[model samples]
Target: MGCFAFKSKAKNQRAAASGARSPAPTSDGQKSKASSASTPTRSIQELSDERGAQRLRVFDLDELSSATNGFSRALKIGEGGFGSVYRAFFRSAGGGGGGRVVLAVKRLNQRSLQGHKQWLAEVQFLGVLEHPNLVRLVGYCAVDSETSKHRLLVYEFMPNKSLDDHLFNRAHPPLSWRLRLQIMIGAARGLDYLHEGLQEVQVIYRDFKAANVLLDADFKPKLSDFGLAREGPTEGKTHVSTAVVGTHGYAAPDYIETGHLTTKSDVWSFGVVLYEILTGRRSLERSRPAEEQKLLGWVRRHPPESQSFRSIMDPRLGGRYPAAAARQVARLADRCLVKNPKERPAMREVVEELERVLQMEPPTTTAADKDGDRRLPPAKR
Candidate 1:
């Protein structure tokens, strides 16, 4: 889990001439975060060049620590298997006067397996990724020899917390069916980006659940947490094999059985997310009848076509939602959770399907739009 520094090919020559061995990859077999396409490679002679050293200044640990109050307890916002997340403010590296910028800093706990490797994974994936619904990686921090004792990652702070907090927390108001459907649409868009937008490198997000989907002020979902993601096959390779790593309820059944990961795994997980949105329930519910504890299992046994769909919709919404919209989302979730991953629709299809459903129904926002526009007159020359 220790951090390792990176050196360009040219730097190796000078180091060899100086009788020093090039640093090795971290023990976990994961690549360095700095090796991603976004990092510029420099030669040994270039290390002494102005550009090489200047590039290093993009991350200022001292300033980051200051922003987080030296990673203070009061700043702590959330925690997950990877580590603790703290809220902080980072100044734009461009020397803009320190304006307000909030960030979530996840500092890895020592006990976690693949601790540094996970950091590298997020760095490599998010550094170059740009998408509206995907959480942006503003920057990251590693354990230099001097700072090896601590590891940290920085991300754009989501003003509204994770979807899990709202869905499961009893104190919070039960999310309306309209809002939940919108959240699903937003999450599907994020998944669509990972599956289709990146050329040559297809990514399967290993974790797709309520907690990983954060909400913005407008309640648009931003998918976060690339720690569990894996690069999909290239050039006709059918699949990628890796240890099964994901939450208990969300892992696709086929992936669990074979350890062969594919884009369809994400589709299965999306089904679980959709189910959560529909029911206002967690993927795993122990309080329910023992036979009904597994959300997907329960939903599969009681498919939407069987007239059990009404019971599946969140009771908290008080049946206020349109029936057709509920049926569309239910059918979409059923398609995603099919036992055969091949049968599931791709994320793009899911997005389009949900959008079609939304468009078919009257939008809640349009009521406000209609009311506001009524006060204004038609433009006149």
Candidate 2:
């Protein structure tokens, strides 16, 4: 499940400050020799076959259970339509010093059809795929001889919570402008990697949204939840046939209407995320009165051309960000929301343009000092 699917303020709060790496408890947890080679370079097909054959080593449920204190309520991180995520600490088989890596364990809901597919897909995809901006696949476990129920997928824990928590939740202070810009760039880079970064062929990430983007302690964005990913036609087939499985507001209109899944579909979702970053709002909203339910539609009606940007600025930001930066973001968002996917900018172009705009951004202000006149180099040294 994507981050939006889960709604836990406490877990989100802890995650907001720290990457998902959990510290090992003081007692009761068993220690095992970390795998000598946790991940060896391998092709996707090879990994997929390996998973089927049980070549992927399984972690003892008892160890994870003990680590999480029997999935104590306090440790329950995030839960979505598919399952609840619990933070756990486990020793690496490779014997690395960072024995306590925060891991997000999704325990699948047995009755959920969508969750079942998502669980397997995540295990398969992350099991093989490796990248920095993308969450790492530590390992996974399925039903077995003794404990043959409850499907679970574990991932490298990220301290900072999902982008949604920072952008929407009020508990945390507003993220600095620099952090926000970096997150956007990191996310775009992650998407760029997914779309074209693979060695053999491209992969299309069908789902892209703020909630799907996790942040580290430094606020670097890491894209997760690839259940809807489809291999590019060059790798397997140019197209795939499956019912749409994305959040409503973020889904590409053409793909939703005609079921044509392509790299452009991901671009459209990216546009929605870009819009969210600029405006600091959910992609879709019904909280407003009935007439204002559709966010994108409302944005189109009150395009940046005709109105003050303040109408869409997040109240929390206090209009503190640069006006030029905001306008540049809004303009790029407009281009991304083009109904014709062909008209939208390519991911590479988006990355390049955002990098340029980020350059124009002023340095971030720190908390320790008053608004002083350091810019004028003193009257006399």
Candidate 3:
């Protein structure tokens, strides 16, 4: 999940440094082949040069330390399987005395299972790939000391944190139905860009979950955390044969069972998040009852077009959502969650369906809508 650390008023004197100037933009023919590989085998320098004019900064460890207050505990905003994230503010030396810039610095845990390899993968992919929905990598830090190695990544600070916090955290006001649809659309566009927007490379977001969807000040959704991202199947290849690596309950069943990854795997995970948006519960929650613990299983019990489907609507919405739109979303989710990978709708199709649903007006609340509130308690699972 995206974390937020407020900036301390103290001025950081550490001078920011920029990497070597990138060469002029290269033609598509000159682009490196390493990027299209299933695993990102290219180094940052290689990819950065290939990007041509898109230079990713090489951050100094001491400068990052000063920005983060020496990695103080109080500044930590969030933590995940990979490492801890700290919010920081530092003046841009390249700006020539401009105001301090905010950043989210991710410090990799030395003991974690994914260390250098995952870190490098992020640098390789995000260092060159640019999109409105993808998080911007401001810079990165790799330091070696006598005792240990320190690896860090710097990204643009997402002010609103993650979609997970807003959806499931009772502390925050519940998301309005329209707002939920807006966020989903933005996220779908991001996935679409990865799958089809790139010239020849199809980036499969291996870990597509609510936590990875970070929101900015305007509530714009941006996909973050590329540690588990991979390039999709190459020419003539049906799928990329690799070990399955993704969050539990979010990975596609086919990939989880056979270790054969494809773009369809990401579609499955997107469907899970779509359900989470409809019903404020998480994809997987062990604290609840066994039957309700798995979101997919619980949702399946309430099929679309059946009376039971109303039970899946988030009660927090208070019948303010359009019934027709909700049904359309449910049906879309059903298609996305189909058992056969071939049966699932492509992300582009999912985006178009969402756009159509967004255009529909919410149904006027009637006796039946009110009854929906009483039909099922908000899914705690």
Candidate 4:
């Protein structure tokens, strides 16, 4: 069952973050590893079939149960429509030198048919995909029998939670302007890699949103949640005409209307998030006044170059961010949100532009310390 079937009105084209069919469930069996040769070097299926197990550890149901305290509610740290994620610590397969590893375990909801598909997608995709800005799938557990079903994934535990948590939650302090730039750039670079850095395959990250961008101890951003990722059109095909599915606000208009999946669709979502970081507002916030209910419609009224643009800047920044850089970021975001998908800048170009944003010198006031003699250097990327 897919989310958001094609509708008559674009407004009616909203989407769910995850829901898709899959190859009939993979049988419950574990393969012993050969060696560490998995890479995005070959086509997705080729890599998954040949070497995915080499890169992933197969956890027995008993081990995962013990590590997660029998899936105790107290240990759960995150959950969505599909499943709940729990924090756990388990010793490595090599008990002597490996010590205990802190991990995040995601357990699928047995009732959700879509959850099973997503679990398989994560197992196959994350098993082969490796990058500093991507959450590592250390292992997985699958048990499907007549009496019980258990599908779970174990990932390196991210200490800082997600960008969405920090950006919107009041508990955490606001991120420094430089830190914000560094984080988004890392995320965009990850997207760039998915789109263009691979050997022969180009991945379209259909779900690109702050919630999916997790943060580490140092606040570096890593894009997680590969449930909706899809391969780009190949063999001269312009787009992958498939079911429209992704977070409603982040999905591109072209994809929503025509099921035309492409790298540009992810770029469009990245643009929405760019404005989000700058404005500290969600794509759609109904609690806000009618004029500001929709972020894009509201922001168009105040172009980045206009004098009122500063009013839209995240007040949490406390006037510390460079005014010029903010305008430039907004401009880049405008290019990403262009109605025509073809006109949107590629992820590589967007990343290069943001890198330049870091090189820019900040105004004295924005960089000065309380003493007014020293300057805060740009945040380290």
Candidate 5:
């Protein structure tokens, strides 16, 4: 509930270092906007060398205070162990006459010295990274003055919030089958970039769950939350060894047991989400019957190859989705969930598989039922 709370590492050990790169003021002494690039590392010395932090804009207390009305509870958009996220607005950069800019400001608790590392990690990584599928880090604020010390991160406003919201909240309209697949493909591309995009280093997203996948106004999925992200194994190294910390039921078993993390570990988590989009169930849902409590365990009973598989699809779908495409999604999810990490398909392969499903012929729409639910014929295999 506290947003990917980490348990293994001592809170003190992760405190912010005095020497890590902190936000710098602009030349004109104005600090409203940044380069608009989205880009992480945790070690203070190591992250400082990356120099990605320099690219970000710095926000003064006044700007943050004005935007959130002195961090009012009314403007609070999200809350967790680390801090609260508030929706804020500011005058756009360049000219005083510029339009208003919508943003989300994450104001970390001052007492959470333990979480300053995570805040810095996000600043380091988001500063250098840029991608359509990765949430953009607009700016940051870090102050250690006498009165108060502030650490805040500014991000482009995600009007649609997160995939977790749309998937689990019954209040929201059910996502169409086509839109679901599209969101998955886009998220896969974001993960693929982290795994294979950087020339010198790869990012292993330690936490890959529905909640971390934020959506823009268009429902475009973008990966967020770099608090637990770690650099992938260097050349010749099999995997990075670190304390396992991720949301329960979403972590890869091998990583949980061995503290060894690889891109494949992310692949496994991605598989869990693959099933999530298909079934509209969290990785671990306890509200169902005893046999259906755990998503993976319950899904195994009805393999994609079996006739019972359709039973696991989100009932909210009302049989409107293409039957064959749905089955293929289940099959792909299984591939991502392979017990052997080495055997899991790469994110690129996962994206390709999903794309192929989208290319398949549309399911023929037949007559609507008495309730007006249109029955869709199974897609061609």
Candidate 6:
């Protein structure tokens, strides 16, 4: 795959990091090395004035430090390529009389691969794009001065952590078939909004995977980490030619080969996660046997009609899930993973398919239902 084949050497270097943020220049001298590289034709400043009017609050460093217990290890909730995230609680300005809010604070490491530019990109995207499925950005801090330099962001805390925590971590109980389907549908809605919801720009969530999907207390899924998001091609353009930057297994093959990205690329990543939801397996497991390392390739070998398809379903389900629903989802996955980008169904179509799968089983009338707890019945379609 020509994953690194950029139009120029500078572009190649800019796309080097798997999760490189947009190359918008920051106030600090740390301007993006590839600021002039290919990008969506529209400038960031061109975003709607209404969005810009809702400016993010600038927090005092001392207050944030207090909130995070001086960035203590005990409060740390997550760590990734960007930096360390901490769980914190902040009270309203009036002290105890005012309500308290829970938040996740991300402190960017000065030495990390992503720096000021990426930080700015996160603020720019999340600052404006508002959706029920997209994580809310509360505020930010940029301490760029001659003495001390620090970059941090505050977000609404997701008590349930990430989808990856539930799907891949052995400590948690396995997600029920109904819950898994719900989560996938929620994620699809988020992607659909990004692809078509905005009036001025088509936002391509370059990084779409389970790890980036956060779940709330009620198991509602929200898309987080907008550092890799990009504006899609304008009218008459087929794709936005830019550097390839995303997680390994979830990125679309066409994007990897040509650096040409479209909404279809996000669809490909969505398909990978759909399979992960179905099988409870990671998209890329290096330790597995060669044939089984890549979940998509291995699962594709067993078409939904084939008897071997049962072998690919999550063993944890113990055959409790509806077979017809599983088969329908598997077919949708096949459509999303097609080699040609054009062949992949749009996010809207994917949402409709998932909704249809949800309707395949009739409502339950078991004792659980009478008690006001309705559980999905086995596949009878």
Candidate 1, 1-381: lDDT as tens digits: 112223323332223223212332432222222112244332222222322223322244566689889989999999888889999986666676767778788888868877756765665556545687888776655434432344577787887788898888878766765567667777888888777765434667899989999977666678998877766653445566778889999999999999988889999999888888778878888999987788877777766777777887778776767788877788888898888988999888998888778666564554433432232222111
Which ranges in model 5 have alpha carbons more than 4 Å from their true place? 1-54, 94-98, 111-113, 146-148, 361-381
Candidates arranged by TM-score, highest first: 4, 6, 5, 3, 1, 2
Give the per-residue Cα lDDT of candidate 3 at 83: 89
TM-score of 3: 0.83
Q: Is candidate 1 or 4 superior in lDDT? A: 4
The lDDT of model 3 is: 0.75
Give a tens-digit lDDT track for model 4, residues 228-316: 77666654467777788889799999999998888899999999999999998999999999999999999999998799999999998
In model 1, the runs with Cα more than 4 Å from the true position are 1-58, 91-99, 145-148, 363-381
Lowest summed lDDT across 10 adjacent residues in model 4 is found at 8-17
Give the range of the ten consecutive residues with the poorest summed lDDT in model 2: 26-35
Which 10-residue window of candidate 5 scores lowest in summed lDDT? Answer: 27-36
Clashing pairs in 5: 38-129, 39-125, 39-126, 39-129, 40-125
Winner by TM-score between candidate 4 and candidate 3? 4
lDDT at residue 257 of model 5 (Cα atoms): 93
Q: How much is 13 displaced in model 4, in angstroms?
A: 40
- Better candidate number, 1 or 6, judged by lDDT: 6
Candidate 1 lDDT score at position 306: 70
Q: Where's the lowest-lDDT run of ten residues in candidate 1?
A: 27-36
Model 6 stretches with alpha carbons more than 4 Å out? 1-43, 48-50, 53-55, 93-99, 362-381
Clashing pairs counted in every model: 2, 20, 0, 0, 5, 0
Q: How do the residues 35-152 of candidate 6 rate in per-residue lDDT, one tens digit apiece?
A: 1235443434355223533556656667789999999999999998889999987986678688877899999987876665667667777877888889988877655444546778
Error at 113, model 4, angstroms:
2.0
RMSD of each: 7.7, 11.8, 8.6, 9.7, 9.2, 8.8
Q: Model 3: how far is 266 from its true place, Å?
A: 0.2
> Comparing candidate 2 with candidate 5, which one achieves the higher lDDT?
5
